[model samples]
Target: MKTKYWTIVVLALLTAMMSVAPASAKPVTVKGKVTAKEDGSVIIGCSVLIKGTRNGTLTDTDGKYAISANTGDTLVFSYIGCITQEKTVKSAKLNVVLQESPEALKESMVTGYTVGESVEDVSSEEIRIMYVPVRQELPSEEYNEIVENGFMKVKDTPLSTFSIDVDAAAYGNMRRYLNKGQLPPADAVRTEELINYFSYDYAKPTGDAPVKITTEVGACPWNPVHRLVRIGLKAREIPTENLPVSNLVFLIDVSGSMYGAERLDLVKSSLKLLVNNLRDKDRVAIVVYSGAAGERLPSTSGSDKQKIKDAIDELEAGGSTAGGAGIELAYKIARKNFVPGGNNRIILCTDGDFNVGISSGKALEKLIEKERETGVFLTVLGYGMGNYKDGKMQVLAEKGNGNHAYIDNLQEANRVLVNEFGATMHTVAKDVKLQVEFNPAQVQAYRLIGYESRLLQDEDFNNDAKDAGEMGAGHTVTAFYEVIPAGVESDYAGKVDELKYQKPEKTVPVSLSKELLTVKLRYKQPDGDSSKRIEITLADDKANKVSVDFHFASAVAMFGQLLRDSDYKGTATYDKIISLAKTGLGKDAKGYKREFIRLVEIAKGLDKE
Candidate 1:
């Protein structure tokens, strides 16, 4: 009887305890922000994952993230260049600050061009350029050439001169910042690059000329009273079978700064894709640099794809960046294996962190300029970020007569190296310049939408000695100009006092008055010394008939202006941009246009925030 009573009492006590016990700790929605400990700046794209679970999410542009977790469950936060942290979930809100990884700090010292186990053993000369952030201060080392293209009066400045720019690094880099829920800096928003990033349906070159010029004039979307003129250069597209034999030098950066998986590892993967596109007639050489420069592979036949890929796979990151030395070595190798009447180029992959010998921008430019005289083209592929030297890379690409592309992910790599192989590697024209003569009778003042760094003096257009931009096979370059008609009034366009010393010019002929502008393009053959000129006359009647491409291009230009907060933007609102972009989203075969719409929406939200 006593035992039965005790068992009943124990069962009753256990049931009471079980009834009061929490039910598996009901899932609670946890929200938090991840920021850099150094500066308290929100870290966009920081990874936040539930510990021991597959559920994870990235921080938005504002460094905010949300996850569902149970009491006592842990959450892990990780970011590149920062230490990973784990926190126990006790409340619905938990914020985190990630510190710079100690391991990364210790690995800053470079012993040689090879990966070292310890930084303490590294010598002074072996040290490469690395981001050494001070405690409580994470300095941004990003570079951008400021863009300041002001308004030009037609009577004072009749000729608009600029180099043709096809480099799309700024667009990709801008996408990076936006996708991470942040707005790109003003300097990073290169208006010309953003305009040229997409393909426009323009007529192909049908004549012996390597490129054809296409011009469009349409009502400006931002200010209907004003007008926008677009000049497009379309290079002839050559079939892959007709491409000449290519001699390529892969100049890779393997410095300590490139230690992350996104840096060296992604580069190896990217190169492997390019290797697959090679032919037996193609020859490739591998050059890697850190504290020093070394040749990893000799000029080997592209038929040996496995060998080339293996060499790339074996690459390890460490040491200091010797970008100048590496460029010299790569060019030397390219010259040694120089193929006449064939494609000869050096593809430099780096973060633009040139620390060692000959690291100055001027020195690098001079080196590349001299080597370009040997008929070797340069292709600069920028990788990694957070201390990326965009200005240096731009100079290298400009002076070396090469294209600049920033590869943020594998998809971009595939686009640049594989999908657009011919356009990316094959040159159609070089030293290309555009000069537009606006009719003073039809226009009062004008402002170029972009291409600040590419602007040239009027004399440079006819000067064969002046260096301009290179056009690749099948590449398209576009430029936008905002014009104020003679009758329209704009606060941005300041009127200049009439020149008392010089008499007022006579009125243009009625026939010429009807013409909006004449676009003159000067370009040289890939291996030619002299430039060939092409003139395109745009009429007022033609300006009234615009295509989807014109509207789309105008939308992109307006977006850039809004992003840069340009004084000439007039009334470019995000909603207005979205509506305008939607109407012209023709074909959008690659969905890049649609993607751009989404980006605008994201920007809209971020702007509100």
Candidate 2:
């Protein structure tokens, strides 16, 4: 009887200990690749989450992901436009194949029209026989007019000055047009943005200066008689771990116009990518605007990523847009939680449609300009297709001492928010302006390829009070000048009557120098009030063999001119552009260059129509 009682007591103690013990199924590292079921193409930026938990990760560029999960825990794989899938984690390696959602398929269908018959040609009686896809009425899209730059006589205007622009909204916006089998409006193609969209292998800054300059001259691809000069500036790169703590406000527009998968939906996904990359030291607040502006999420630690993402996911589109009110509230929040000497920025995501108060571009500009004085920079992210207000977004970004980008797809989001995180969020230099002084001895007449909107008074370069563009860490700025060599009898270099009241000024001794041009740059440190200046001289010698970047940039410039139907695009053909891009397609690890070639081909077909 004693032995029985002791055994029973021991069993009871063992059962109690077992009930108090931790779970036996320890979390193991699970690795897998995510791909599409239809074509088996790898899907990038897919979210892999452990069921019933906040633990999740995004797939890398190769569609590979690793996550910790228990043996019986469920793993959920999801991506925009793909159906969500769940699988039990039976083993360490579990690959996932997601199917395209039916909604996505419907949205992806392109409108088809019967060939060889114009809508006017079809009679009412025969209209039923014509095959035409049903589509919604076209929305009125607005784009500011772009007047191409004209050649200036070096003797008359010796110095060409402009603010440096790192925005690449034009490139992605242009790509959207071509992808839809249509040509972009002439005013929509910004040449400099197209060239700067791709990364270049320029030398990094080695000194105290945040930017380094590289200059090269080569024979113009379109007009061989004219020389092409490339000026490249590479900003110092800061590693992700070394970046400053951030105080970010996500100012999102949730207006009635944003009610679509491509507008608000895309904005949410893009912000999530950014949220996933945030460090624990950073903080984020979300401000949304519809009929009224309100703060959906207060300033929260970056460690609470799930909370931030939940706020983003809960957003829905409705009512009118109170953009000005939203901006005011966002700035207020940013200033209230201001992190001294840290990166404080507001990221505005919208279709740029503002129907309520302070909707005009000038008003928005003024409001942002005032808010910018509080040491908070702005980053404008334009989204959606129809009714996109590019003009207003441009003014806000330019006046707010910030940068602008257009997010057209998930891949673009990955590129801007993930791959180029440092360059997209951290500003190392602000108020950067460039001035080029042409030498009459080496060049007769020259025209800046683009940047008509960024032209600055020659005096503005020396004025520290003037506002200019900001450069982010790891950002690269590229500009091109098409030069009419001295003695070239071109109509572009038309003779100007000698000044009636003044005799020709004596040529300076520097004109005798072999330099083609002097490039001067001015920029202020992120938090500094005063500006610093740097100058570099480009020799007259033309490069016998230009680098791959130079060739690719020239191709992009020619393509832009062609798209815009500029008066200066001499002998530029789509075939020539494609060939040049092919020659310059170095490594192309990201495949952006190859995509450029494909876009050129698509444009060629659309141009014929």
Model number with the top lDDT: 2
- Model 2 alpha-carbon drift over 4 Å, by segment: 1-41, 44-138, 498-503, 506-511
* Predicted candidate 2 versus true structure: per-residue lDDT over 1-609, tens digit per residue: 999999999999999987876555667889899888898877765667777875666665457788777888888776645677899887889999989774432222233221121111111110000011212333687889998999999988989999999999999888777767678899889999999898899999988999999999989999998899999999999998899999999999999999765678678877877887889999999999998999999999999989998898899999999999999999999999999999999999998999898788888888998999999999999988878888889889999988899887666777788788889889999999999999988889999999999999999999999999988999999999999988888999987687899999866636576789999999999999999999999886665478998889999999999999999999999999999998899887766787688778778988898
Location of the lowest summed lDDT over 10 successive residues in candidate 2:
121-130
| lDDT of each residue in 1-609, candidate 1, tens digit only | 999999999999999997886666668888888878887777655666677765665564456777777877878776644677899988899999989764542221111111111111111111111211111111464666675688888877888999999999988777766655678888888888888888888899997999988887888899888888888889999887689999999999999988764578668867876887788999999999999999999999989988988798789999999889999999999999999988999999988989999999888888988999999999999877677788899889999888999886555776788768888899989999999998887888888878888989999999999999999889999998888887777776776677889978765635545788899999999889999999988777634578888878888888998998887778899889888888889886555786677678778877899
The global Cα lDDT (0 to 1) of model 1 is 0.80
lDDT of 2 at 591: 60
- Those runs of model 1 whose alpha carbons end farther than 4 Å from true positions after fitting are 1-138, 498-512, 542-544
